[model samples]
Target: MSEDGVSAGGGKMRRRDLLTLIGTVAGSAVMYRAMSAMALAGESGFTGPIKLEGDPKGASVLILGAGMAGMCAAYELRKAGYKVQILEYNDRPGGRNWSLYGGDTYTELGGFTQKVEFDKGLYLNPGPWRLPYHHQAILHYCKVLNVALEPFVQVNYAAYVHSTKAFGGKPKRYREVHADFNGYVAELLAKSTQQGRLDQAVTREDQEILLEAMREWGALDKNYEYRKGLLASERRGYVSDPGGGTTSAPIPSDPMAMSDLLKSGLWGSISAGHIYEFQNTIFQPKGGMGMIGKAFGRELEGVIAYDSKVIDIHQDAKGVTATYVNAKTGGPPRKAQADYCICTIPASILGQIPMNVGDAMQSAIQALYYDASIKVGLQFKRRFWEQDESIYGGISFTDQPNGMIGYPATDYFSDGKGVLLGAYTFGPAAFEYAAMSPQERVAKTVEYGANVHPQYRDEFENGVAVAWHRVPWTLGCAAHWTEALRAEHYDNLVAMDGRIMLAGEHASRLPAWQEGALLSSLDAIRRLHQRVMTS
Candidate 1:
């Protein structure tokens, strides 16, 4: 070959390599840019001074809070063609359902296991076994996504959390210790049932049947008022000894009595036959819960405003207009316009937003709750416990502070090389945990595990914390139905006022879960579509 020909070939190769590098760099830039934009938008805390342009042609819509619910609402509305733009105050969507990506791994920090991934521990004793609402939506979405799931007909799983301690010095004398747990459970249920309406939530016909069984078994020397009081004592966080210790104060009768009665009643009726027919038949997806969230976000990406924050929203007679700042724009916030607005921001934060709306909207926003939670996900250097695919356990804290331990992710292919454990917590204690540094939080988590699984303390020390309360957009974890909070308000939580709409996990038909978030968004969209079409 001639020297000139060799040089010519080298030049062509150089050009080709340069083009390839450029393409790769550009692609990475886009992803990084998108992530940064969303993060900044959330930080701007734009419930501040903002402006908007004229409402776009047609009935354009603006939605806020891009968690699962907001994402679902956008997905539905976009298809219906209302020029929708979802404003996610958070850097990313999925609300509480978030995953961390490090190296070649992913872990779920919030949300429950996917319906398809039923056996990954954390498995719901499905059916009547605490369905947690979102599981139903998960099942539904799985079908839509063409994901597969299986049911566990019979699985031996025993690990749970409760607010009670073991009996101490005094209770040891009573012959009560002889009763097996099943017997105790049976006796308690029978006693409560015989007392009448232990579960106020049940109907008259069912109550009679429950009472008859309780009457047949016969109960201990009874104290209708006393037992009810003990239940209330613990219900208020004054956990008592499981060995039959009593509380000092008399328990209030109304809610606590009903609550305790129902629990005893539930356990009494629960059986393997009942489980097969009622609960514990969990379903799992082929992949993890992350797959489901990724699928939903992937499908709805086009409609989501990844880097925009709705700084302020204003609505007049015709429709509502939203003002958003571009996190990507950097210096000054960029601007975007929308018609119908479906905001998924928690009502707690919404109260702080200075958006232009009526007193009702403002009042509802002010009433929202952002329960404190500490979500810790640990990746051990290795799996240190006898982990069965079916059984998951949670540790209970009787007084000061408590923790829930869960096996959130299993290294199916990696042979347990790395495992993900999760827990849910709320109240002032959660706030304190959230205040710790990443390293400090990890240390605390190790202490938490070391208390229960002494063998795995070092393994746990190798873990990390994904403190949601610290995250700007979320600023908290999990929602609860407090005594002061009304269940029905959840339905009207996002009631529409003029042209504005609301949606989020708290505003769902289900208890606060990923399913509720997704379902709430869809619900908002349905209402929005009607408002626009009929308006």
Candidate 2:
């Protein structure tokens, strides 16, 4: 050995050097796993507003679809001095950013039509309802458009989490489940430290600090045990709330046993609000989510051509051409020509449209698959949830087919009728709900909701259901991208082919979100503008 404790072959091996050598020999998969273990994941790519400095010099752009992506493209391109026009299948704009209110009619793909009969001022947002605080693009547009926004209560202590297999099918408050889970987990870690099981992992001085933290965080007794007492009750709740009168006093509730708490599985739903995307300070448009779309429509008064169904897209060195027909009349096809094209149509529908592009783009277009989802809105005669159950707003989770019930964030303590998102299902449950007729879907939603809110049977007045798979315009809810699919096709899907570019949630890193659409549009325009300037 050398004087510095080095082997004959080399100096002493450092940890990072060994990792680098292992990564070089083992490949990217090993490197990725090592980075993940070290918590070195990258931050979001979205930085700020995308500035397209150069002008297009009077070049025109034909945008397909009037969804958030398409509309945002049209709005920005027009501002940038590019003559922009949009073709939309639906008479209205906003695409999936829609809301169904009283007297509204919707027809599905199978020719089944439903008329909403909710009371005035009540509505149901079928898609893209809640807006997270981190979705800066969406919030910026909403602010620019002067749309009024209100807080969306994502988590309520009084909200319920029900598992059919647990607690004899009784729904428990979110706070109780959350408090108990944290308390038990903290107690377990504290106990293990005291038993010297974590001696290797934690230093003796640090162990004392950790024990104190766990005791405070878990609301444990002086002995570091999670047990029935006032300490636990303060975090969970009191059996009888403290009263002001001399005859009444608060009674601490008994804490659930650690074994029973684990078996209940109610702890599973507690972390939903903690997710980065669903965290606190979520917001929604005041009247409905559709208000955002309506505001965009109002701003882009004559730019959108309603009821124009695009049949094909062909691009050449000169320009791009799109053929379309009137959706209402099925009239002869008309051609729209532009120097460049930005197609924001969902991949689910775009795959069917005959388009002339490279083989890579064609393959990418057909590779994406849209997700299936269903949302049902129920009109109630009264706000029984607030008056009787004391649940103001937030979601109540269940293991049943309905999946979850979302209380309305607006209209608190009003004497008028209220609307609630009775059922929201996805994946297999969404397909199951979509298979049923609109009326049947509504009836079943009431039935499943009654299991949680017994007042549903009496208070339910009317309902409307929107199964995204049956939506004629979109065919399905939003693009579903897997790691493998994204790795192979995502870049191809977004890259400009000839004079044509794609912009939508499917084309961006942020899928199924308004921010994704905005970012996708901004990125597409930036590239297209660059191409125009160079040419």
Candidate 3:
């Protein structure tokens, strides 16, 4: 806290510098915990239900943008005896918590309307699809709303890791890349230890144990060698799968050469599942992610004013008032006022709207930037991935600009049509695809996806592409924050200014996540309630 960035313990380290040191010495998992402790990041600080103990004494609240943050605020504030009303631009609830089903229509920024032609019961979640187990607030709401949940497969060995520069452009199974890479790494280490190369670092007894551990962990042969044999085949899979008949003898597939594997760069995709967020036990709603939004909308039956877009936000000595017009039938502007306001609009759109806040807040709003992203949902004629490739419900990574292909996690072994997340691109790739027409985007996904799954050429049915930057509601995917940006303006953006406060992912350390929005709303409501009680 000193001018020279010195800690009280005689250390010369600023907050950001200290965090960087921790991240360098320790891994991301440890640094994330340290960051969470220092309030630099969050790991879903949801410890059971929020306790809004005191009443608001009939104070009214006007909420803007019925996304996760706004809806969460209205639901909780109303329950705590505060009169709550919400103004949502879209007809439905769940801003980014949306799903596109058959007959669902979306009109992007440039007046391009896409009518989804998916089969009945098929859906594509254009926004969030998977919920990490740690996001307890959203999970709690799901449980409260009686929304059924299902498991989401994060890693499937039957899935693929593809690179155009690798293996003559042939896609490799995830298991092959994973097994071969781990096997080769363990073999090298084991040989080094056996030759006493690690004597300076590892003791004799420790080296022996390490060798044993590596042999087991990497499925190495007794000689600690990774080659075309039963050990490697067991890990990577057989050339011909073990069967039940007279021709049941499985053929061991040859392991890729270590140099070839390294050159392929497919090993990079294998470690993605080991990341903290993408780890096991992820879940999704039984129907779609939008089910949560639909549930929220139904619960707040009469409270939300749908299709009402706020044109301007103004606060006075008494309360906050929002000027608005009907989104669909903009005849004339209307006004909605309340004792306090919690605005959950995305910064991308909010910056363009008229809002009278302090210069700090205004500057923060304009300073924040939203990242570009795009997702293409393609409906295929049959369950070819499951039937032909034995890939059930996981993602197949590709080095192509389209990013990855995600198979549907639900309805296994079904005879009906299925949808595939053919392309999920970000950054420059997203902008490139966004430049194209929706149909062109869909076609590009099919073209790129065919390299991984050739069935796309024959089984393609219909498709819909959602470019986040073009989407009218959000304009971009989520808030993109750098360390410097967060330091300068994050507090100004989140702090309650007079009778108005901002609540969304942009207001929390956990940006681009629904949990951040919910947490921001909870924090805002708690502070607002305290202010009301004290006043």
260, model 3: CA deviation in Å?
1.0
Worst 10 residues of 2 by lDDT: 1-10
Of the candidates numbered 2 and 3, which has the greater lDDT value?
Answer: 3
Model 1 RMSD in Å is 24.4
Better of 1 and 3 by TM-score: 3
- Model 1 gets an lDDT of 0.49
Question: What is the number of backbone collisions in each predicted candidate, taken in the order shown?
Answer: 18, 0, 0
lDDT assessment of candidate 3: 0.89
Off by over 4 Å in 2: 1-46
- 304-374 per-residue lDDT for model 3 (tens digits): 99999889999999999999999999979999999999999999899999988999999999998799889
RMSD of each: 24.4, 8.7, 9.2
Cα lDDT computed for each candidate against the true fold: 0.49, 0.87, 0.89
lDDT of 2: 0.87
